[model samples]
Target: MHLTDHDRAMRDGAEGDAIAAAMDLLIRYGEGLGAEVLCDVRNVAGTSTQPTPAKTIIAKEHGWDKAFSVINLDSDADIAIPPMRVPTCQLQQGFNDEVLSISPYRSELVELQDGAESFASEKGINILATCTPYQVGNLPTRGEHVAWMESSAVIYANSVLGARTNCEGTASTGSAGLTGRIPCWGNHREETRRGTHLIESDVRVESFLDWGMLGYFAGDVVGEQRPVLSGQLARPTLTDLKHLGAAMATSGGVEMFHLPGVTPEARTIEEAFGDTVPATTVHYTAADRAHVYETLNDQGSSTDVDFVLLGCPHASVEQMAEIARLLDGRKLHPDTRLWVMAPRALRDVADRNGVTAAIRAAGGQVLTDSCPAMSRTAPEGTRVFATDSAKQAHYLPAILDIEAWFGTTRDCIEAALTGRWKGELR
Candidate 1:
């Protein structure tokens, strides 16, 4: 791989030991990916504060700087960590302290996370603490190069915003945050960004649920390759596209997709494919949509729902307001619980808008910073769960050994109210 003068200087230890270590990792990573050169990036979203047993051990024995050395930089050397060189934000981590009494999560872990947040903030890392950073303040422009770790965010960046990035990992993003450079491979190149598959949906995909089902079907049909979507589709909102992208990334390793007229990269189907013909053309009909829905709901067999989790990638302000409206005059069942996960910034907006108050009055809570899947904990004695998010429905069952029912927002709210899974594919 070729490196510029600045990159070479960093690797030669001119910028201090920590930055040298980060450059070393980036060079190795770029070589492993067979990239020819390194690209400059100003935006980076990654995980740093999440508490793990390994990080805990490292911090206890060697201090937080040493923990960052071994975990974030993949280096064993003892070096003084510096403030991030570029714009960087921390991603979703363990649950906060507020949920400890109601949840089975360890209080020690929450305290550990609180300390971790302080450390990251001191290092100049913005503690966004949510998967969906674009919805917050870090909206990357079209054609902007970024290093983002979350799968859903990666897809949204490449597909929705036209920003270029691969589905980065913890270490790569860590390095990129310090050096502002990433391997120019995969989605970074213009030619490789073209679509590899064409999915024409014959079924009417207008609702949030329909888009999610279609995204799941597209991911299953074309695993890691990009897909260009056309045919019966509605002009989706930000929330709808968020659901679609999250669902696709959950079901398969989809990093990027194109909705042709909807997305930014491609204005037409022809442009999406470029000079290359689509490798496969799959038609997403009603039967295909039903199959995806059934697959999402397959884990659930019990009707007595104990938990209804919303926001796999964290909820937007619109989704929060919608939930408040759904639970306006209703109260949750005594046996069931509902939690709406969102970013703290957006949660503040919801609080100011009376959205949080309305949901709280109806026995629901809008929590922020972390989710059950990240923390690996849920409400006590939750054997069955229902969610409006396709990603959560696809993951929670395997993560928690629980049953999941996938449906619309109203369906999930109804389950929270009546303690039953009466939701069906509509």
Candidate 2:
């Protein structure tokens, strides 16, 4: 790998042990990936990554700082870790102890999460612990470079916000936070960001669910390549875009996509493809939507919804407001449980606007700083599950051994109210 004098100095230990360690790791990464240079990352969003312990640490014998380094940084170096050079925030943790009653080791897990938050904060990491860090304050501009860990956030930053980043791992992002550098490969290059496939949707995509199906279909077809969407998409809301990007990242390894006239890169179809015409064109109709719906929901039509989850990408303020509106005068069935998850900042905003109250009045929970993917715990006797997020529906069934069903947000609310799955894409 070719390194500038500064990088070489860092690798040679001129910048002390911590920076030297980081630079060494980066050089190894660059060599392993055939990258010739390292690029500076100005925005980072990966402080909440919890390393699985090899064995249980039964007692607090070591200090929290030391334990944090061992668990998060994967290093036990004596040097104190430096602050992030750029804007940085945490993604979601495992679960919130104040609300969740599922984890058997609830007390210990919460302690570990709290320790992680405090340690990262002391090292200048903004511990928001929400997947949607942009909702709080870490909004990166178009074309700006960043190092992000959350897959959904990576896709959103790359495809929707036009920021450049690849889906980074927890350890690599920690190195980026320390050294502010990453390998200039993959989506970091401008050439790889262009559309390689064209996707057309004949269905009118107005809601979040419709956009989600389009994204899932397009991403599966194109795989890791850039997909140029030539569909008639209305002016979608932020929630709609979130659903699309989240499901796209879920179903496929898509880092970025271009939607002509909607996303930043594709002002026109020609702009998306540059000189080359799209190598392949895919079409999505009502039949495609039905297929996606069937693939997502493989459950029987019965009155047996044990759990109904919302907000896989973490609900925005507008989504929360809409959910509140839907549940204003309604009551959930006694057998059903609704879990609404989002960033703490947005939850506070919803609380101020009486949205949280409306949800709680209807027996729904507004949880923060939790990712269902990380937690295998569910409500006791949970057999049938329903969710509005395509990402959640894609994973929960296989992970939790429950019958997961996908539907519209309205359909999920109706399921919560009546304890039934009455949604139809047909």
Candidate 3:
């Protein structure tokens, strides 16, 4: 593979041991993938909490600390909580406690505290462990190249924002920051951006959760390819889009999708495909939506729900406010444990807006910098769990061996109130 002067210098160990090791690993990764050259990454977003100490230590050594320190575009801190970490763990064989002790996971109860501090002191690359980097300030302009690690962010940036990026992993993304280049693959090319699968939805999705389900449906059908979406129901908000992107990322390896009139590139069906869509278009009707529900909610009937989780992609202040409004004066059932996860800044805003207070009064705990899937902070002995996010409900159970259920936010609130999954809500 060809290398620039800087790349050669780094490879030759002129930059010092840590950077040199990182570059060598990057070169090997690039070579393995047949990446010819590297591209500069304008922003990076990754999973907030890591499970093992080895992963966290490696992330920190590369650039996780530096990425979270700066504000991305949209003026909000570009931080997001993704569903990547184990929910809970016990002492097990082959687990390395000594490695885990390298970084105190909760030594300081603040977002990006250890990573940010380490970045400042050690002078590593910038890396914010948020899923929604575009919202927080790492907004990459249209056509601007970036190397983002988060799956949803990759799709959102490339499809919605018209920025270019590959669905790169955390380590490669960190290396891109140091080398200032990424291999021109995936969404970086124009021809690769066209939709291979066509999706037409007739379901009337009114809630963020519904959009998430739609995304899951699209992804499950389309698999790892881009899909062009036509037809719709209600207008989607940013929060809804976030859920859609995340669900798509989880359901499949979809790095980009075109929603007619919604995504920047796809104003119309013709525009989305440029006349290259497959002859057959898959129609997702209300029945199809029901199919999605049935497929995702595979767990058998379980009246008792031990845990309830809200806020995948970290709820925005506005979303929290809406939750608070729906939950005012309503108490969560004593048998149910409720948790709300969001970005630290948004959590603070929700507190000031009394959304946090309302949720707490309704028997919910508001946590920042992590989600149930990312932090693995669910109630002990939680055999049955429910979430408003379809992506969470679909993936968490398989990972944690718990029975997971998907429902509307209203339905979730009703379950929390009743401590059971039944009645009109079910």
Candidate 4:
């Protein structure tokens, strides 16, 4: 592969060893993907919280200063970085601790520290720790280019926001931050941006859970192709779209999907497809929605619930308000531990709206910057767990060995209030 003058300079150690090595890896990856020129990446989202030894060593060797000096640090908008770990259910206690202990100096935490110092020495970039960076104003407007690592964020930005980006990995996003360049593939190209799969839903979705189920169903059928959704439903809120994006990403390698009348591209079904949809269109019915729940929960009779978690993309202020309204004078079951995850901004809004007080009064704690599914912090030996997020329920069992129940926010609220899994009708 031919290298640009800038790429050649990096190879010649213009930025020192660490950066040069990182750049070499990125160049190789770009070459592997047949990317001739790197697009300018104004914003970057990553997947891991801690840096690996290789990444840290590279950063340190390059003098973190020169490695990430190209990023715009004055922005208050948060960047969606990668999760430190993938969702897993292997019952290895203290797994993360072991990894961290062995590679203390290398991790997202260390990288974040290094990044903080590097950014501070230059300009301070806002760090909002969550997968839903777009929610906190890091959105790339229509046709604008960006580098995002989080799968859901990539899908949302590309499909919903009409912004352009490829589904990148943690290392690639980091490289983009350092060099401000990304391969212009996938959603970045106009030809690749058009919808390939046609999804027609006959069922009416009333809650965020419904959207999650729809996303899972669409992803299962659509695979990695961009799906253009059509047919009946209310306009989904940002929270609803978040669940949809997360569930879709979890189900498949989908990085972008358009919902007619909701997403920027799909103002109409025809617009989403540019009048050239696939001959076969998948129709989602009530049975399909039920199938989503059944597949996620697994066929189980155990109803003894121990944990109830909410917020996948993290709850928005409106959802928090709804939770507060539902639990205004109620208390969670003493045996059931209910946890709500929200972004720092929404958490503050919840506090101001008295939603935080209501949730706390009802024995639920609203945490900021992280979700239980992402953190792997659910109580050990949790036999029966419930959540409003299909993505959470789908991945949690494989990593935690817990029986998960999928339901709506109301269902979770009821579970918290009663401490029992509300069995879905098969």
Index of the highest-TM-score prediction: 1
199-253 per-residue lDDT for model 2 (tens digits): 8888888878888988888778888888888766788888888888888888888
Candidate 3's C-alpha runs over 4 A off are 47-51, 55-129, 423-426
Q: Per-residue alpha-carbon lDDT of model 4 for 216-328, expressed as tens digits? A: 99888978888888777778988888888889988988998888887787787778778575746889998888778889878345787878888777777888888888886
Q: Give each model a TM-score.
A: 0.99, 0.94, 0.82, 0.82
lDDT of 3 by residue, 167-192 (tens): 87655554454445566666887788
Query: Candidate 2: deviation at residue 254, Å?
Result: 0.5
How many clashes in each candidate?
0, 0, 22, 16
Off by over 4 Å in 1: none
**Candidates' C-alpha lDDT:** 0.92, 0.80, 0.67, 0.69
- When superposed on Cα atoms, how far off is each prediction in RMSD? 0.8, 2.1, 8.2, 7.4
Candidate 3 local lDDT, residue 50: 40
How would the candidate models be sorted by TM-score, starting from the highest? 1, 2, 4, 3
When 2 and 3 are scored with TM-score, the better candidate is 2
